[model samples]
Target: MDQSMASDLIGDLISCGNIDHAMVDGNKRPFICLELEDVSGNKLRNITLWSDYAQQLNDALGDRQNLGHVVIILQFMKHKIYKRKPAVSSMFGVTKLFINADIPDTHTFTKLLIENRGSEGDDHHVTHLTTFSSYSIKNDFLNNLQKVTINDIRDIVKPMSCVVVATVKKIEREADWWYLACVKCNHAAKQESVSEKDEYGVVVKKRSIFRCTNK
Candidate 1:
């Protein structure tokens, strides 16, 4: 499919994934390995980039510290997994994932700021203006902030859309599932249930409730 067509179908085609690893090979090629799950939650998928595509992703990463919000177009091909806990080769099908790493303009940022500022207490408001503002600042400023605080900021900013910013404080892994803690209450809420297990053979039990920590 054409890039524009792919962009239009992103909501339906591309699934959201967590960045399990971002590695740069000896050749200095950047690769983003994602742990993506579909709506059905059938299995976790891996997405990878090779050659020049790697360089592009690396450049984009340099522009933005986090890849959670950045949108990219990917052409996927299915591959069979013969073993459980499949390796990267098994998880990521052979496909071309394309990305256009252009930063949002000032006007777009301003609109996001206004929308988030207006929806201060609304549950539906999910934009993280504060973190966006912080990210917009120079790296030197980020250096001054504590590592924990920076992680907190990124967590808050990553999953948010243009309209809403969902800040995740703590994550709990339960029997084959994962839950995110409420930013307001720090309470664990069931987000997703997975079938993966730890090395110790313990079934992870994820929490189902999340509340704002402020309350």
Candidate 2:
């Protein structure tokens, strides 16, 4: 079947990755990425869940990883390109998800997956699970924990992590959207002149930057 025409997916979910963020209306929103094999094909297809749906998948997957590969049935979902690759996403109110559900479709697909599946060494993406909870950021930041607004930040007396929805009226500095950071420590690094170089006639200063070894 054509990729776009295939709305329902059933197979062994390779892995569920971290819950990521995307910018929406100047606010940060959460999303999740997944990979799974479909009954019709041997290769794994990329899947994504956005907003509350991502939280729902996290909710439904509590302690299930100990059971091995999960057979997921995504019904009424939509296919789209995420980060320039073929992937699927949930359709808000329209989509329904079944995680290792005890149903006929799940059983049939499970058998096919077990029979035709090969070594998982070829699967490219290895995702880290952030947490396993059915908590939606839209409903609250943490499970039963409310999100704070920009105006609510000043009244705090103790240090705590917070989730907020705010617009970027202006950046503190121009061209500060991207920066270089140490991959190991994740600390921002600055550039400096290391040595002076004599090219042919004019002298040039060589700049060194952000090569943090945590030494």
Candidate 3:
């Protein structure tokens, strides 16, 4: 959808980033920044939920862990031009929010999300209980990609994980298949070459490096 839509934005959408929590320095008000993306994994970065609306959805989600399976519906969003680029933001208290609510739209989207993973999603008890484990893995896949295909592995891409269904046709054993992962997390560690130079610009020592940007 265009960021500069004249009407509200209601779609099969999900959050693309961690819910941010911080206090506005001036007034010291809590606010959340919900990074949004459509069902096709297209990011809607221009869509900004204002502090009021952001707080509304943040409170509705309850346990932040439920973010993985949430499908957000914004009833009446607004559009504007910020910094010369088209942008969207909430209309103060006018916009309505829904997260995995038991409405027809939510049910339809929940069904689609589950089927994308080749699974039956019609668990009456689970659905009624709102235990949307049905979309956790599938939505994680949607988080990074619009579709899942084992063939996409050959394409040079950023390091990320997604759920995919594929037959284990063959295992290549000619070389090492294991890789080094971060001890603190499951993320694969990236290797880099490091070189140290003497004060006179002479090469002294070399080493392989692994570092975290956010650390």
Candidate 4:
């Protein structure tokens, strides 16, 4: 079946998986590794794209410049533990189906979000919908304007990762740490620490520090 046509089957289609590692086989064919999750909070899914579909996806994701809406149709296979964490395995993936989707004209979606802000029904629906809409607008703006690099896009969309874009007004560097000031809020606790690199070339880092612009 055409994956794009199955878009509606994908429930709560809000986010797209980030392509972390992609490899081509000895036959010069491509395969992709994607990190995906659903609204259930059950667990994150690791999807593998195989064969020709894989090659097509790899090319489509080249440079990752196009932050278009992705509609993926996947079938759950089994569960495996990698790094001692439970992960669902998936197959048959697609990407960049809507590279040409007009995102700037998101007024209707914005209106829907505003109308649902005070909704008292399912909180899960409300939260996911609002988040999806916000991210969609942000992605559209960033991609269409070509203001951010692929790494920036990955950072913004990574699972459970928070991203904020603002002008840096000031920086404070200490012996072991550094802090950034929020141009709008002037918050002081928005600090980040630098990690020491090990001799083996491994660097361990913590989650991103919180910063409130209060704008």
TM-score of every candidate relative to the true structure: 0.26, 0.49, 0.42, 0.27
- Please give the CA lDDT of all the candidate structures: 0.38, 0.68, 0.58, 0.41
lDDT of 2 by residue, 1-215 (tens): 24565487766665676677877689887888777767566655567788888887777767544546577788887877654778777876888888878899988877776666653334433345443233355445455776567777879887677767567797677556787778776656666557665767555766665565434
Clashes of each: 16, 1, 0, 0
lDDT of 1 by residue, 55-166 (tens): 5555555534333333344555333232243323211334555443243442343345346445322232112212222334566455664444434554664443322235
Most accurate candidate by TM-score = 2
Off by more than 4 A, model 2? 1-6, 39-41, 63-65, 117-215
lDDT of 3 by residue, 1-215 (tens): 46555455544334433344444455553334454544454656555665676666657666544234566777777777765777766665677877667898877866776666444423311111211233375676667666746676658377676656667988998989887777776557777889999999988999999864325
Better of 1 and 2 by TM-score: 2
Sort the predicted structures by lDDT, highest score first.
Answer: 2, 3, 4, 1
**How do these models rank on TM-score, best leading?**
2, 3, 4, 1
Answer with 1 or 4, whichever has the higher TM-score.
4
Expressed as tens digits, the lDDT of each residue in 78-166 for candidate 4 is 44555465443334443322222345423333334335544322332211112222347667766775456546765554344334577
Q: Residue 199 in model 2: shift from native, Å?
A: 53
